[model samples]
Structure formats: C-alpha cells, structure tokens
Target: MSNLVEFNETSAPGFVLLGFTERAELRLLCFFVFFTIYAVTLAGNLGVVVLIRLDLGLHTPMYFFLSHLSLLDICYSSTIIPQALWSLVVAKPGISFPGCVTQLFSFATCATTECYILAAMAYDRFVAICNPLLYSVLMSQRLCVGLVAGAYLAGVISSTIHTVAIFHLPFCRSKKIDHFFCDGPPLLALSCSDTHLSELVVSALVGFNVLSTTAFIVTSYSRVLAAVFRMRSPPASRKTFSTCASHLVSITLYYGSSLFMYLRPSSRHSLEDDKVVSMLYSVAIPMLNPLIYSLRNADMKRAMRKARGRVLSLATRGSQAPERRGGPLHG
Candidate 1:
C-alpha cells in the first residue's frame, strides 16, 4: 500500500534492490557460487566456535577472543549472505522498508562489534607478548567478559543511532537501492529528504570507529613487534610473530576493504565498486577466517584431529555395542 501510494505525505514502503544486472544468464551461476560461499562461511565459522568450546586446552584468552570473533563472523555473514543469495536466485529482489532497516541495523551491529572485538584481540596478543608477567592478571576472566560486553553494547548503540537516523528520513519518490545489501550510503541515496545530517552522523561514526580500532590494533602490534625483536632466540621470535600473522592478515584484509568502501568521499561513490569491496568483508573474509586460523595454528589442528578421532571412536563403539547385543551371546 505504501509503495503504491504516490509522493504525498507517506514514506516509501519498500525498496527495489538492483543487484548484479550485468548478465541475466549468469544469475543462476552467481546463485550457486554464492550459495557455496555462504555454506562454507557458516561451516567454517561454526567449526571454530565448536573447536573452541570442545577443546579445554583452548581456554586461554587468545582462543577465548577467537571464539568470540568466530561467533561474530557467523553473525556478520548471516546478516548479508542470505539476502544476497536470495537476490541472486529470485527474479524480483525487493526489500520492504522495515526489512531494509532491520538489515541495516543487523549489519551495522555486527560490523561495529567486529571492529571492537578485533581491537580486543589485538590487546590480548599485546599483553601475552609484551607483558607476559602481568598477562594473566591484566586480561583476567572478568576483564575479558567486560570487554566482550562492551563491544556488544557499543555495537548496539551505534547501530541504533544509524537506524533511527535512516528511518527518520522521508522517502517519497525513489525506492531503488543501487547495491546488493542495506548499507548506509545506498540507503541515504534513496531518501527524498536532505541527507546532510545522516551523512554527517555516518561520517563521524565511521571515522571514530575505524580510526580508534585501527589505532588500537596498530599500537598493540607495534608493541608486539618490539617485544618480539627483543627476544634472544631467533626461532622464538619467529614463532611469536607467527602466532599473530594470520590474525594480522585477516585484519588487514577486512579493514582495508571496509575503509576503502566507507571512508571515501561521496563524490567518488560507485555502486559497482562498493559491491565488490563489500564482498571482501561480508563474504570472503568469513570463509577465510577458519582456514587462516586453523591452517596456520598447530594447536587448532591438533585439537581438530583429536576431536575428529574421538567422534569416530565413539561412533564405532556405538555401532559395535548394538551389534554385540544383537549377536550370539558369549559362553
């Protein structure tokens, strides 16, 4: 009804997402490709969560933060990938106003939460490497929990503000979103009303979140590098750096794409380029997280192997027990 109404007093009810309109023939191929990506993202991140939970040896602060990161990755990918996959498969890729707002809130919350979580992880590594004597006391269980809670709280607060700002805008005419997902910029572009306030708020929040988190990560790693260099043994230094290499790589990929997409001037906005950059963070990064962490870390591999072995042994015993009960009894 709202969508049918002309530009009068009511806001637009829904948005038509112009997703990947290059080649109609390639839609199905895109669908299956992204479907596989979504599946892998879910499986990989979920595996990390399970590994962290089942392996008691991974109860340290590093793994603790890693489990949280894995959970965030799952949440992060879920906010976008399902809709993206559906858009690829479905003919009419439309999202209601409320649906778009909800997606934006969810995406923003997850993204902001990830930024804070990554910073917390960097701090964890900093303490472990730089201040080994005070590491346990500094990154205590209570403190870690508090840090995690703070991350979620910050995410919620920021997302709520952005959602409110976007929803308050009047959208009477254009209802087409130029991108695949409900991001701040594309949504702002669709609003009939002046978006100066919305743009300002987004810019301020984006700068604060990105700059602060980047600063924390940079400072942490700088100290980590210093500490590693001071170590006497070359192998020990290499090992110390190796522990953080995967995380650093992931951070670079995520933040690099994110910053390039969001922090750029609006004059340079290109929907096509934005979608490509978003894929780096929304899709590819989630799929790569588990691979990077598990493949690079020896402990995770051992835990995974042990877990697999246990599961198989249990399954074998279960089947044999039933067979033995059903078979001829011993004398």
Candidate 2:
C-alpha cells in the first residue's frame, strides 16, 4: 500500500509530451487545423445541446440521449485540445504528473461514458423500430434517465479502475510521452516497472468494454434492418434508417479509430501511428458528430434558422433605435 501510494503521488516525475515538433513548417498548419476543429467541436456540441433544450419536439428519448452525447463530446475534446495548442507555443511542453493524471481521468471518464451511451442509443432505436408498440412503455422517461445515469456510472467506474491501475505502476524510464495526450497505451509504454500486469488489465478492460458495446450496436441494427425490410412502405424504411445513419457514421469513425489505437497489443504501439489515430478519435470525430447527427435533422435546422432570425432582428432593431433618437441618441 505504501509503495503504491508513493508511485501515484509526489514520486511521479514531470513528463514531457513530445508532440509534433520535428516538422516546424507543418506545425503551423497542424495548429490552424486543430484550432479550427476545436472551435467547431465546441460550437457543434453546444449548439445541439441548446437546440434540444429549446425545441419541444426534440424532447424525445433519442434526442435526450443525443444531448448527453453532445455534452460528453465537449468534455472529451476539452481534455486534450487546449493543452495541445499550448504545447505548440512553448519550447518545453511538459505536464506535471498530477496534471497528467487529471487529464487521463477526465478524458477516460467522458470516453467510456460515450461507449455505453452509444449502446443505450442503439437499444432505444431497437425498441422504437422493432417493437414500436411497447416503445413508450419500455423506454419511459424514468427509464431513459436511469439508463443515462447508468452510463455515467459505468464511465466513472471504468476510469477509476484504469487510473488506479496505470498510475500504480511507476513511470520511471524516460519522463517523456511521445504522444500529445496521456492515453493508456502510450502511458503504459513509459512504465519502468514490469508492465505485463498493467498491460493485461488495460487490454482486458478496454477490449471488453468496446467489444460488448459494439456487439450490442451490431445486433440491434441487424434486427432493425430485418424489421425495416419486412415493412411494405419504402418511405417508412428510409425514414427509419435515416434516424440511425448519423449514429452509424459516428460509431464507424470513433470505434474504428479507437480499436486501432487500443485493442492491439501494446508492443505494437507505434508512437507516430498512434498519435495520428489519436487525433482522429479525440479531435476530428467530436467536430464531425454534430454535423452528422443534426445537419439532416429538419427540426433542428428549423430551430437554428429561427434562432438566427431572432438574432438578426434584435440587431436590426437595436441599430435603428440609436439612429431614430435624433436629438442626443438616447444618451
């Protein structure tokens, strides 16, 4: 117990995050691209959340899960992007050991929560499409709330296990992490202590969590597809499929990238390859999720248009009022 505490606490050394400094010319481009991505990700996720709140028609089980998903995306991206941008500006970009642990906890919690949230969403779609008669009964407001709470609980539990396990292993080799963030596979590579146990634990945890949710999604969609084909209405089938298309796209991008990064043996982890893949799941997908999920949503589009109109109208009225006050301009 004393040894483990020492490993996790002040004994931890300051670690340098050796990001993309080799290509000076490309760093500028990378910075702009990532900055743009970060900005868009924030806007997109927040926009969806706000839209869901304001639009009454969007207060359904599907959008309920979607709002929470947007929240997770915001947190997940925030955990890494700001630090990454800051690293580009400084000569020595190193995070304190505590800061690294905090980053890992925050990102892991959000990411793990997302996994189950996606599964819950799949189950919701399954009930709605496959068993529409009992959809309302099975996916009640109380049940939706419980499922969301469970997803968050699962995230907390998973992150706690991973954080405790990984940090207990002393990282005493080179105090330099080659990737941009404090991810599990890369952090495991830095441990001076025997990492076979840590590696085994991490792989088992990550693999089970990812695979179970993925299997759930696949199984639910398979049933949904079968049900879709059985219906005689073409328009109904199209509409039903449209509801899940965004989620499918998001799953493909995020799951595909994450599986490539973490599911493999840690021995096969290439810093260069892992870094690029990290950017995809951590940065790019968050930005793309809002677009994929909400762009085709007619209700959200209508709500956004109304919000934009309201802003323009308010600005126009304010501008005219100042000019209309002829004498002293209402000063």
Candidate 3:
C-alpha cells in the first residue's frame, strides 16, 4: 500500500505534449505554416458565416446548414491549432490534466457535430433535388433548427461519455503524450489501467458516427444523381450537378481524411502518421471548406461580388461626403 501511494504521488498530474518534431528549424517552419493556416481558416470560415447571415439571397435551407458548418469549422480548427502552434515554439509544451480533458471534449464535440452537420447538408440537398416541389415544405425552418440542435446535442453527449470514461481511469504511466494534441489513442497509451472498454466505446461511437453519416450522404447523393439524369433539360441537370459538386468536394476532403484517421485498427496506429492525417481533417479541411463552397458555387461567388460592391459603395460614399463637406458650394 505504501509503495502504491509513492508511485501515485511521483507521477505528474500534467501531461507533456511532444509536438510534431523537436528540431529547432523544423519547429520554426511548422509554427509559421500552421499560423498562416489558422489565420486563413478563421477568416474564411467566419466570412462564410457572416456572408450567409447578411445576404438575404442566401436565406435558404442549403446556406442555413452551411452557416452552421462554417461555425463548426471555426470551432474545430480553433480547438487544435492554437495549442499546436504554442506547443511548437515552447521548450516544454505541457497541459494540465483538466486542460487535456477539456481539449479532448472540445475537439470531440466539434468533430462529431461536424459529422452530423455534413449529413444534414446532404439531406438538404436530397430534399431539394429529389423532392423539388416539396423542398421547402419538407425542410421547414423548425426542422432545420431542430437538426442543428440535435447535432450539437449528440456531440455533447458523445464527448461527455468519452471524456468521463477516459479521464476516470488512472494515468500513472509516462506523462509524455506522443502527439501534438490530446487525442484519445495517445492519452489511452498513457493510462496504467486497462482501457479495453474505453477503446471499445470510442471505436463504437466513431464507427457509428462515421458510417451512419457516410451512408446517409451516399444514399442522398445517389438519389440526387438519378433525379438529375432523368431530367429532360440539360441545363437544369448541369445546374443541379454544379450545385451538388461543391458539397461533394467538401464531403470528400473531410470524410476521407477522418475515416483514415479514426476507423483504422489500433495495431496499425502510428503516432507520426496520425499527426499528418489529423492535420488534414482538423486543420486543412476547415481552411478548404469556405474556398470549396465559395469558389465552386455560383451563388457564393455572386454574394461575394455583391458584398464587395456594397463595401466599395460605402467607402466611395463616405469619401464623397467628406469632400462635399470640405467644398464651398453645396451646402
């Protein structure tokens, strides 16, 4: 009993996050690269949210869900990137046990919420394409609100489960986490207790989330394609395809990387490999989402132009007002 008490007392209460690499030059390069990505991600995702909100033309089921998605991306990226950037430059990048748990919960919530949001977006497209006449009626405002709420609720529940289950276990082993962020597998590796059930719980939840969302999206898109092919008007079909194309790209980037990261067997889990893959789904995807949606979708392009025009007009008017006031004649 005394030896056990000594062992527990000697273990650190905080965790050391050994970031991507330890070399000084590489750390500098990583810091700059990730800082730039974080800036772009914040600007792009926030722009999407603001644009959707301000532009009345974008007030539809598609953009409604898209706005929520942008918020999620912002949150998702924020949860990981700042800490990672800090960890890169610091001599000792450590996080308290509470902080680690908080990060895990935050990161998990954003990720899971994003999964359902993407699925919801797919369903919105399904209704619009597959049930054109009844699109608005089916995807009513109340229903959309409920869907978003449900996604968040589901995320919170899943995160709580994972956080409680993992942190409750004793982590008496080495305090050095092998990855950048406080992710599940690395944290599990630090535990002195058996983590079989925790592993099972994580795998089950992740599998269910990933597979279910992917299935819904695939099924939705399949029906959409069939409906498009059946359309007699080539232009209409093209337009339908164009609208769905941006969504397809976003879905591919997020789900493809996430599936690669989470759904793999534990035996093949490599910390080094996991960092690169996690960077994709967590960091890169958020930066790409706004660009994907805006650059490809005609509506977003038009909205950008209109918003630009408004800003330019406001600036011009403001300048003219100052000049008019300074001039002698037009009082």
| lDDT leader | 3
Please, what are the lDDT tens digits per residue for candidate 3 over residues 42-83? 999999999999999999989999999999999988889988
What's model 3's TM-score? 0.94
lDDT of 1 by residue, 1-331 (tens): 1222133213436777767763656766777878899899899989999888989999998898899889988988888888887776655467777898899999889888999999999999999998899999999999999999999999999999978888899876677777888888887787788888888888788788988999999999999999999999999998888889988998999899888987888889888898889888888998999999998887898899999999999999998997788777752
C-alpha lDDT values of all predictions: 0.86, 0.85, 0.89
Between which residue pairs do clashes occur in model 1?
Answer: none
Clashing residue pairs in candidate 3 are none
Worst ten in a row by lDDT for model 2: 1-10
Best by TM-score: 3
Tell me the TM-score of each prediction against the true structure: 0.92, 0.90, 0.94
Q: Give the poorly placed runs of model 2, Cα more than 4 Å off.
A: 1-12, 312-331
Provide the RMSD of all predictions against the true structure, rounded to 1 decimal: 3.9, 5.8, 5.0
Candidate 1 ranges with C-alpha deviation above 4 Å: 1-12, 319-331
Q: Can you give the lDDT of residue 82 in candidate 1?
A: 87
Off by over 4 Å in 3: 1-12, 329-331
